[model samples]
Target: MPEYNAPLRDLRFVLHEVFDAPGLWARLPALAETVDAATADAILEEAAKVTGGLIAPLNRSGDEEGAQWANGAVSTPRGFRQAYATYIEGGWVGLSGNPQYGGMGMPKMLAVQFEEMLYAAGSSFALYSALSSGACLAIDAHASETLKRTYLPPMYEGRWAGSMCLTEAHAGTDLGIIRTRAEPRADGSYAISGSKIFITGGEQDLTENIIHLVLAKLPDAPAGPKGISLFLVPKIKVGADGSLGERNAVSCGSIEHKMGIKASATCVMNFDGAEGYLIGEENKGLAAMFTMMNYERLSIGIQGIGCAEASYQNAVAYARERIQSRAPGGPQARDKAADPIIVHPDVRRMLLTMKAMTEGGRAFASYVGQQLDLSKFSEDPAEKQAAENLVALLTPIAKAFFTDTGLESTVHGQQVFGGHGYIREWGQEQLVRDVRIAQIYEGTNGIQALDLLGRKVVANGGAALRQFTGEIRAFAAADVPHREALLDAVQRLESTTDWLLQRASENPNEVGAASVEFLHLFGYVAYAWLWSRMARVAASKRAEDEAFYDAKQATADFYFRRLLPRILGLEASIRAGSDPLFGLAAEQF
Candidate 1:
């Protein structure tokens, strides 16, 4: 079985040292009463116990046994039900939920760290609760108070789980083309009739009921996306008095046999005139649903980081114990038959690559989490707007870039393991399979890239990009390690952005053609900025904790020396424009 211990030291460094999260929380009136350094640390410690001691052990067995389907009911792998009960009892699902609705009201910074641990423990298991938290966010943001009072408490208390039902067999990315229909009823509710495919946690035995936030269009609604409406459909109906009623018309027809995350129940749901309460206005469901999607997107991106972190831990442990070939320099361990793989330079390279990317991603996720907290809790108008803008600007990168590098990090970790990595016994291969879905779902990384470069960058005339670069420059003004490298990276990203903008003015497809490469460019530069900050903080504190801070400095150096140069190729590709991409005819291929 694979083992995982949460990086509490690194997490603390990012939270307290790198970001001064306690200070920030104190500054925001809403959070000041709730979280302090001691409380946050205590939460992290308990979370590590749950994640490492409880959930991580179940990952392999869960994947092996998978979820079982019989008739319309789906049962998760063994130990999942008990694990989930323990998990929810800890108030984990409601970590960032509102306090009025049976939640703890913790800041998202803690939630982000907690989410990393949860996903690292088990991706399939994490989805069951993560989806509920996300759906709760949407309902809280846009639903009527009546609906909130009736549904939010049970969902937040973990008596019920939540699922997002948006996709149909006929539609994937194009929600505008979905054929699901909603008919208005005599009272206030609506009758939903449709089939939604690939619904995560759609049907599961872990909870008493599954609440579905479904998207469907009305009869006289417009032809496209604007006509779509959001509905709260439950597997089992609930009364106004918050008591359980009979099973609703909704049922899980079947579950998909998947490539990975086998323990997660991905279901095909059929809603045969299921009674669903309308969420928000009739035609504004997309906007409301985005509340959940945005939350889920970030949560999903962390899935990649968590999986890669698990893989990294496994590979590093194996490298130290497994004696294979001799080191190129000499036999470091003459007592053994062969030197441990840790002495090999190639192995070191792979390990360092994983280290740099994973650490950089952790810091970035924390930074984004801080922004989320600020956007929600800050009273100052300017601060709130600034936080909102950063949230919009970085959400796509957080989702796409983190997962992109996450895959790279995981693959490198597997390479460090060599042949054993490919075997299921080592648990490295399962991580690769699990994280692969992070890139495809929650708006495919490609779509996220386009959203970043096209909508957030070009459509805004690069205002948001300029604001972000300005912040990067403000930080680079400090005398930190590799400051010049970071500045050069920011310049390269800006120039590339300008080039894409000008090209897009002439060729519409330029944005689409260069988006993915452009996103990577932005990602590398953003990490450079973050690593610089971490390096600066680590330098002054090296005396306090030599080993930890020294590792931070070393990883920062490796990232600047090796990984940041990746933008050179991405810039060249972005400047190449869309012309070359269109040369091949559709029929010729």
Candidate 2:
């Protein structure tokens, strides 16, 4: 297996060159003192060592000896417990947590790079810690001060882990129909009675306790989604003195036999009147849950990029080593049977495509991470609001497009390996299976498109769309040599937005019908902006590192000349809206 190295150079380029994250960090009062260029670079270097040297080695073994369920207890694969111990001991679980609560309080922009490395190293192992961090963030933000004090520190230290229980067998996307219930008791706490399926990190031996943020409905609460409430139900309840009490009512019924991420335990949890405390106000669970959901949605997208990076590294290594037919014009390696597979044009195309998409996705994630920071820390209220709106508008696109492209890139990487790719030993097949869940979970890509079209775009009368497009236009107008490609991308986005708005005005079903294509079109345009910015930065830094910089420029050129043209096909499909999608009769089949 090839060793995984964090792309620190690319990360720095995206932060300092593409987004100027240092300037943004300096402007934010909360981050100004803690996160400078030196600090960020040092963090990246350490994260690279931990991920590449320690975590990557366990990936293949983890897959082979996946989490095992004996009786009701879950046991993680070999080396995972030790790796997780190192991860927590290094304070990685709290990289972006509150400083007051024992967290490192790192900015999301910097933490995102660490996240990318974790995913690249071993996504299955990373999932457990990521969920813990995300759940802790939500609790710290919305839960009572008492709850935060009780839970936040331990979770940050990784003495305890966390899980989010939202999905049920019948109520995956439609939470309005969920059957979970929470009954109030004499004390402030409630007894949660429900069964949650597909709960990641729900039950495991890696931690002393598992804190679950579950959604259940109150008996007297209105009805549907409006009646739902969020609860903090721990596996083992903590007494008022901060010591462990009796085990809570929650139990792991069974572990899921998933297609990928086998090392991460996904369980069907049966909460039989589990002792639970409300996180926020009643009937507002969805609103509070969005705090965690939004974070996870973007994190899942990074998971895609991370897996794609891993796949690309392995594929590139394989292509350079595997010998095949000689070059068309001349012999590059006459000592071998023919020449290395890297000399082939078609293999080069596949590798380049993966490179372009993976790098583009990294730049895009960094850009979104910057927006998230600005939204929380900007001094001006208007700037904050604009940042928030941008985050909302682009989040679904980030989640859907990055993961979609990730799966495609991983498949292409697998193709580069030919028959060896299909076998488990090469680890190519695992990357494909693991990346696929990123699209399906955290609200499916189809649901993400619906959210973008119905709630964010059409319902808001294109306010968010206009805000995003304005920035893209301004970037294109700036001094970038790839101005033509940038301008073309901007115009294409404007055209697609106008068509969707006009068609959806008269046709109610048009938005849903065109949602997926619209999202892809938006993603292509967004990636074009990132590619252009990266190309300019790479060109300016050519003297420092010619190979890396040249690679960036080549990929950008490929994205513009080859990949951006796909928007035409999507636009055509969107313009032919609703009719084909909803026109088919019910009994036609």
Candidate 3:
């Protein structure tokens, strides 16, 4: 198995050097006194230590043992409980929760770094808390103050955990057809009766109670999605006095056996007259549920990035140590029978591609985190609205593009290992299987692409897209190394957007057909912009640190020269429109 090390220096580089996150925190009144550069650095260091020393060593072993399901109860792999105990004792679960409820009250920017490290170390262990954080956010944003006081503290203290229960056997992306029912009680709580599938961390021994944010329909409400409502359903119902009461009517029927992240339990939950409390106004559930979904979407996207980082580290280490055929130019290592594989051109191409895309993704994730911070903490109304717009526009792309490229990067890493990658001993195969789910869950990549183009772009008359690309052009105005290349790439995206918008009016299918390609085009351009900004920063600071900055600039150069041109093919595909797609008759197959 491969050893996992936290990318501490690069994480700090993305936070402090590339984005000036500390300066943003200082400017926001809400975060000014909450965190600073020194405090943030200390937090990052400690996060690295916990994840690397404790959690990472369990990745392979946990997969081997997997989560166990017996009768109505589920148990996690060995060491998960102890590791989770140490993890929440550090106040890690509530890192970005509301300060009024015993959370650390840190900005989302810092939480992003910690979450990335957690996923890289052990995805199965990381998911238990990931769902809790998202569920906590939903309850904080919509639940009443009384409910918040009763639920948030114990959850933050790690005595309880949370889950999101939205999917049923019949529904995945479309929620309008769900059959879960919620009946109001005289005590103001509701009785939820239904079953949810694919529930992550639905039942686990790591925490005492599992708080579920469930979606169901009211008996006296209208039909379809408008009638749906959100509820806070707990495994063990909590009394208003802040004490654990009898177990609710919910039970885990079974747990899934899967390809990767086997240590994380995917459950089938049966809620027979389960006690649940209303979250927001009745019949407005979908809107409230999206608040949690958006947060989970970004977190799940980071799962892809974390796996990619682990794969890169493993592949790079092996490339340097694994001996193979001699170099094409000459025998680089005369002392050894065969030269190191790193000396070959094809191997270098694969390694460099992984390096460039993974680092580029790190920068973009931090940038999204910065926007989230601005939208939440900044007092300026215009700045807050701008940040909100960018978040809405970019969140979908982050979920889809990062995972799309993430799968590609992981496959390349596995290919670098040759036949060894196919076996389980090297740990490369686990990463490939684990990262594949990111593209399928939390709204599939296809769903994200549709949301980006259909709702965010074409529906808004390209204003949201222009809002994003305009920022890129503004930054590209600087005299960076790839300034012209980035500007051209942004222009290409703008033109493609215009073409798709015009075609969508004439033929609605154009929107769906052009969506994935359009998103990939936007993703490539966004990375080009970030890579340019990184190259400028690395060049300016090269005098202080030679090797690190030199590597940064070289990777940026490679992204522009080698990877940036791939956007040309995407542009051509988008221009092809939806005619060819509809040519196939429904009965042809």
- Candidate 1 lDDT over 1-589, as tens digits, reads 6899999999999999999999999999999999999999999999999999999999999999999889999999999999989988988888999999888999999999999998988999999999999999999999999999989898899989999999999998999888989999999789999999999999999999899999999999997889889999998899889999999999999999998999999999999999999999988899999999999999998888888788889889989999998989888999999999999888888989888898899999999999999999999999889999999989999998878878887888778888878989888888888889999998999999999988899999999999999998988786878988999999999988888888899989999999999989998999999999999999999999999899999999999999999999998988888999999999988
How does model 2 fare in lDDT? 0.90
> Which ten residues in a row are the worst by lDDT in model 2?
580-589
Prediction 1 TM-score vs. true: 0.99
Candidate 2: TM-score? 0.98
lDDT of 2 by residue, 148-167 (tens): 98999999999999999999
Q: Please, what is the whole-model Cα lDDT of each candidate in the order they appear?
A: 0.92, 0.90, 0.92
TM-score of 3: 0.99
Task: Tell me the lDDT of model 3 at 528.
Answer: 95
